[model samples]
Target: MRLRLKGARVVDPGSIDDYKDIIIFDGMIEAVIDPSSPYPPVMLDSSDPSSVTKGLKSEENDTNYSEAGKIGVDNFPVEEGDTNYSEKGKVEASPTVSGEGYTNCSKEADITEIDLAGMVVVPGLIDMHVHLREPGQEYKETIETGLKAAARGGFTAVCPMPNTNPVNDNAQITAFMVNRAKSLGGTRLYPVGAITRGLKGENLAEYGDMKQAGIVAITDDGRPVENARVMRRAMEYARGLGIPVISHAEDLSLAGDGSMNEGIVATRLGIKGIPNAAESTVVMRDIALAELTGARLHIAHVSCEESVDAIRQGKKRGVNVTAETAPHYFTITDEAVAEYDTNAKMNPPLRTEQDRLAVIEGLSDGTLDIIATDHAPHSLLEKDVEFDRAAFGIVGLETALGLSLQLVNNGSLTFDELIEKMSKKPAALLNINNDIVPGNPADLTIIDPDAFWSVNPETFFSKGRNTPFAGYHLRGEVYMTMVQGTIAYHRTDGGQ
Candidate 1:
């Protein structure tokens, strides 16, 4: 099948940024064509509905295409006098060849064309951190539900943590996850294997076996590897296998059963608090380990000013360390917990206003490499409890982009930088290619930058509805997401 996505602004970070047409064939991008090139003629059969050009517009409209069979660039009838000429936008009656921006499709071939006049096309977003509770904890989320939510959120791929009930510690569990996601068929899933067996922080898992079974990275996500020696061995082993060791950087003793950030908010509420040192101290240790072992280390969900500075300084010393932070860390502060809102609670809990600013600065200055959603889903049984007893996370996959777009809106990062952090950088880290180039998989996201919508958890595709941003208005929406040349999700109501 041949698909021509016409007249959309193609924003593929450093590669391309212009109004162009994308040609997709058989689940791959066949070509990126400049709309200004007039070599390929618009071929259309007025009698055939499917062959009619889509996105028709008057000459007053600057857009070059039309909706399904009217006068437009891809398919317009060339009349005798009023507007038809050979040198102009007229197509040859029967040209059977291909040119710079044109392909002559045979009558037997099926061609589907969509006119995306005002949309922006980018590489599909990838979330390096998400929790899809399958294999054991299906009540909270399944592979189907989590993948659907990721697709609707414009993520083409997601890396699920290995914190399932049984934990993905071996080849059997890793293969089960990979096969399940493949069978479901939507957003791609790359499982991150457990670093320590059972996340116990003692015995290291079989990195070679898990990597063979298809784990992209290794991490003891929900539980930190408390033993420095164990973590160092894990990093060294992962380095030999050429996979990054993702760290859940938190000192359990320092965190000490805290429910939220250790600050005035927790103090006033009389709740247990987790101080900044709880996370930064571990982060510093991991960086030192990475430096000593010559291993790639990625710090997950960095939430404080001290951790950001640590990572920045590590990079300065030429340490092989990379880090990520979630949107909630920068968008909101510990103050969101002022009313004892359990939904606002998360591990390495939201920090102070100063910490939030530091995170934004880290991202702007390239200290942080990726913006991943630690999309943990929980049932009401875990979330409806008291503040200190509530679950430590909120469903983030659906709200990540909307919240992260605030950075661009506030001039904290450029549009290109945001796309790089969300799509390009993550793909590079995971060793996947999601660029909008010919021969690459047609995994793309179409966005409506001005589309305004309220954060309604009821409308979310994820099973979990726990969110701190519910009812908050956000701009920039995922208009449609395409994976492997197939439309996985399309926003129905357009915009709220």
Candidate 2:
């Protein structure tokens, strides 16, 4: 099958960022044609209204296609009276032509020209850190539900952590997660194997075997590798196998039984607080280990200013280190827990506004290379409890983009930079190339920059309703998400 997506502002970093017509065939990008390029334009048969506007009805039909776009196996949106070739114009590309058509090349096959005007198309977003509680804890989240949520969140791919019930430490568990996600088929899941066997932090898991079984990286994500010697050895082993070691930068000893950030808010609320040193000290230790072992070390979910400083200093020292900060780190702070809101209670708990500015500055200056969503999903059973007894995460897959867009709205980061952080850079760290170009997989996200929507957990596709952003108004939304040339998720209502 052939498809033509027309009239969209394609914001592909390191490539063309113009109004182009993208020709996709058999799940791969065939060509990206500039609309201004000179080529013969094929005319449509106006006498046949069906040929003029396929699947779209006129005013008399009483079936308005423009009100809310429809997705079918054989039909795409083509509004009546629209002229953006993507809408009303059609170029019948001859299969025999080479470098002589509206596009540089044409396949003499049927093309579904979709009008994507007023939309911004970018490479599919990837979240390098998430928790899909499957293979054991299906009560919290399953692979199917998590993938559906990811697709709806405009993520074409995600890397789940190794903190599941069975702890993805062996090749069997890694293979199980991969196969389960593949069978579900929507968003791509790259499982991360545990660094230590059973996450005991004593013996290193078989990195070579797990890598062979489709594991992309290794980490003891939910818990930090407490033993420095074991962490160093794991980094050394991972470096040899050409895989990254993702560090959950936290010192449990320092963080013992603390519920929130140690600051005025915690003091006011009379709750035990986790000091900033709990995370920063471990971050410094991991960075030193990465430097000594020459491993590609990645710090996960950096929340405090001290940790950001440590990562920045490591980068300045020419260490093989990279870091990611989640939207929560920059969007909200421990003050969100002022009323003891359990949803705001997360591990490496939210920090002060000063730390939030540091994370924003890190992203702005290239010190923080990626924006990942530590999308930990938990049911109400775990979240509907006292502040200190609640689980340590909030569901992020559905809210990451809307929250990250705040950076662009405030000029902290340009739209292109935000897209790169959410899409390109994460893939680079995993040693995967996700550039939007000809011959590459047709994984794309269509976004409506001005669409306004409120955060409603009842409408969320995730099993978890644990989020602090509920009832908050957001100014952007994901209009559609496509994976491998097929629409994985599409907004079918006029919620905007």
Candidate 3:
């Protein structure tokens, strides 16, 4: 099958950024042509729902992706970077991002065309720290629903934590998740294997075997490896396997019985608070360990200012360290919990406004490498409880991109930089190649940076309704998400 996307401003962050016509065939980027080129003629059979050019779009609305039919072999000039690529000499990326964006149907089929005029087409977003509860806790979220949420959010690939019901600590659970994602068939789901067997923090999980079984990075997320010796062993083992060790970076003992950040609000509410030290201490320890073991250490859900400082110092010291922060860390603070909203609750709890700004600064200065959602999902039973009794997370997949774009709109990051953090940086971290160029996977995202949309959890694709930004008006919207060259999610409205 062949497809052409016309009239869109192509943005691939660290790669290519310009107006281009994209041609895709057999799930790979066949070509990236000039936007001024005349589009191959296409016809719409209005009577047939599946006809080419059929789309839920507004007339000339400026970004609807309609189907195109016809494969005209033309001499299109390709971008130099599109043709040039460094070989994959790096270690395997964490199970991350999408196809060069294609899925073949029939070679003889007519070309499908999608017009993306006035919209921004970028490399598909990749969230390296998403929680997909399956093989045990399906009520909160399932593999199917989680990936749907990701696709709806413009993310084509996500790395789900291994702290599931069965704990993806072994090959069996790892294989189960890989096959389950294959069965669900939407955005790509990569499993992060647990670092400790059952995440007990005592024994190390089989990193070598788990790597072979489709696990990407090894992590003991949802819980910290309190035992330094055990964690060191896990790192050494993963280093040998050549995969990253993603640390949850929290001192449970220090964070004991705490519900929100240790701040004025917590003092006023008379609720126990978690101090910044809890996260920073672990980050400090992990960085030292990474230097000691010579392994790549990636800190997950970094929320406080001190942790970012520690991570920055780690990088300065030449430790092989990378860190990620969620949208909530930079967008919302513990003040959100003043209303006792469980949706604002999360592990490594939301910190003070000072910390929030620090997170944005971290992104701006490159102290932070990625913007992951840490997209933990919880059910009503878990979130509807009292703030102190509620679960330690809220669903995030649906809001990460819109909220992050807020950073762009405010000039905190350039459009290219935001796409870099959301798509390219995460892909490189996971070792997935999703360059939006010829001979690459056509995995891509079409975004309307100015599209105003209100958040509504009731309409969310994820089973989890736990969110604090439910009624927040967001600046951008995901027009369409394509993975492995297949249309995965399109805005119901024609991206006119």
Candidate 4:
């Protein structure tokens, strides 16, 4: 089938000149033509005899024509002795109309022409960290529903964390997630392996076996490996196996009995707080372990200024350490928790304005490598309880792009830079495909960066509606998402 997406401003971040008009045929890009090209034949109007002249007049100023004045009534090929014309010039008959050709070509080719006049066509997004809540807790989010949310959010692929009820520690469970996601979900789900058996943080999970089973990375997630020796050993083992150890940077001892960030807000609300040191201390220790063991360490949802500084130093010192931050960490602060909103409650809990500014700075300066949704879903019954009893997560897969674009459009980040952080950088981090060229998998996202939208939880594809940004006006929206050249999601109705 031939599909032509014409007049789109293709933003391929890997290139120097980011915008171009691309032609795709048979699930691959045929060519990237300049929008100024005049090769694509314009359809002639059969109803009006004067239509051909109008078409020629439109292209009269084209650079392909040297003398625009040469085209006139004498040059136009009109029907000989036609009553519409005063005189007959060199009569040139209209091209033959082939009914059979039109039928056979239209049927066989299945040409789909899309005029994306003011849209930006970018490589489909990849999220390296997300929680689909499948295998158990399907009431909160299933593999199918989570992928649907991902597609709506312009994500072509997502890596689901290994924190299910029966954690994805063994080869069988990892295989189960892969199969279910492939057969039943819209977005590609790369299964991550648990760092420890059942995420107990005591005994290491089957690292080599899980890697053989196709798990992308290993993480305890929410449950950090607190013991330095245990973490060091896990890192060394994972490094030997050529996989990364993702840490949920937090010292639980310092975070004990804490419900929010240690700040003026927490104090005013009379809630125990988890100090920024809880996160930074773990980041510092992990960087040291990574340097010592030469292991790839990834800090998950880093939410503190000092932690960013630690990661910056780790990179400067040539430590194999990378980090990702969630949208909430950069966009929201402890002030949002003033009303005891459980939606704002998340692990590595929302910190002060200083920390928020620090996260934005990290993202802008490349200290933070990727922007993930961390789309953890919990049932309303779980999140609607007391703030202390509420689950530590918020549904974000459906709103990740919009929130990221809010930063870009606000001049905090460039569009190409945002695409790099969201799509190519995440794929590179996970060692996945990061191509926008021909013959590559057609995982692409179509975005209207200027489209304004507001968050409405009722419209969310995920089962969870625990977003703190509900009803907040945001710019930019995903119009369509494709995975492997198949349309995964399309917003037929106009977005906000």
| Backbone atom clashes (below 3 Å) for every candidate | 11, 1, 28, 1
Candidate 4's C-alpha runs over 4 A off are 16-19, 36-110
Judge candidate 2 against the unseen true structure and give its global Cα lDDT, from 0 to 1: 0.83
Question: What is candidate 4's local distance difference test score?
Answer: 0.80
Per-residue lDDT of candidate 2, residues 1-496 (tens digit)? 8887877889988775777767788888876665332211222455643342332212232222221121111122234553444333323221232222232223443578788888889999999999999978899889999999999899999999988878999999999999998888788999999999888999999999999999899999989999999999999899899999999988998999999999899999999999999999999999999989999999999998999899999999999999999999999999999888999988889999999999999999888999998999898889888999999998999889988887898899999999989998988888777777778889999898888889998888889888999998988889888889989899887863
CA RMSD of each candidate after superposition: 6.8, 8.4, 10.4, 8.4
Candidate 2 — which residues are off by over 4 angstroms? Answer: 36-109
TM-scores for all predictions: 0.88, 0.87, 0.86, 0.86
Which of the numbered candidates is closest to the native, going by highest TM-score?
A: 1
Please identify model 1 stretches exceeding 4 Å from their true place: 36-105, 108-110
Model 3 error, position 271 (Å): 0.8
| Candidate 2 C-alpha error for residue 277, in Å | 0.5
Model 3 lDDT per residue over 24-88, tens place: 98888877765533233222333542333222222332222211111122234422443211111
After superposition, candidate 3 runs with Cα above 4 Å error: 38-110, 494-496
Q: Scored by Cα lDDT, where does model 3 land?
A: 0.82
Quote the lDDT for 411 in model 3.
94
Residue-level lDDT for 67 in candidate 3: 17
| lDDT tens per residue, model 4, 255-279 | 9989999888998988889999999
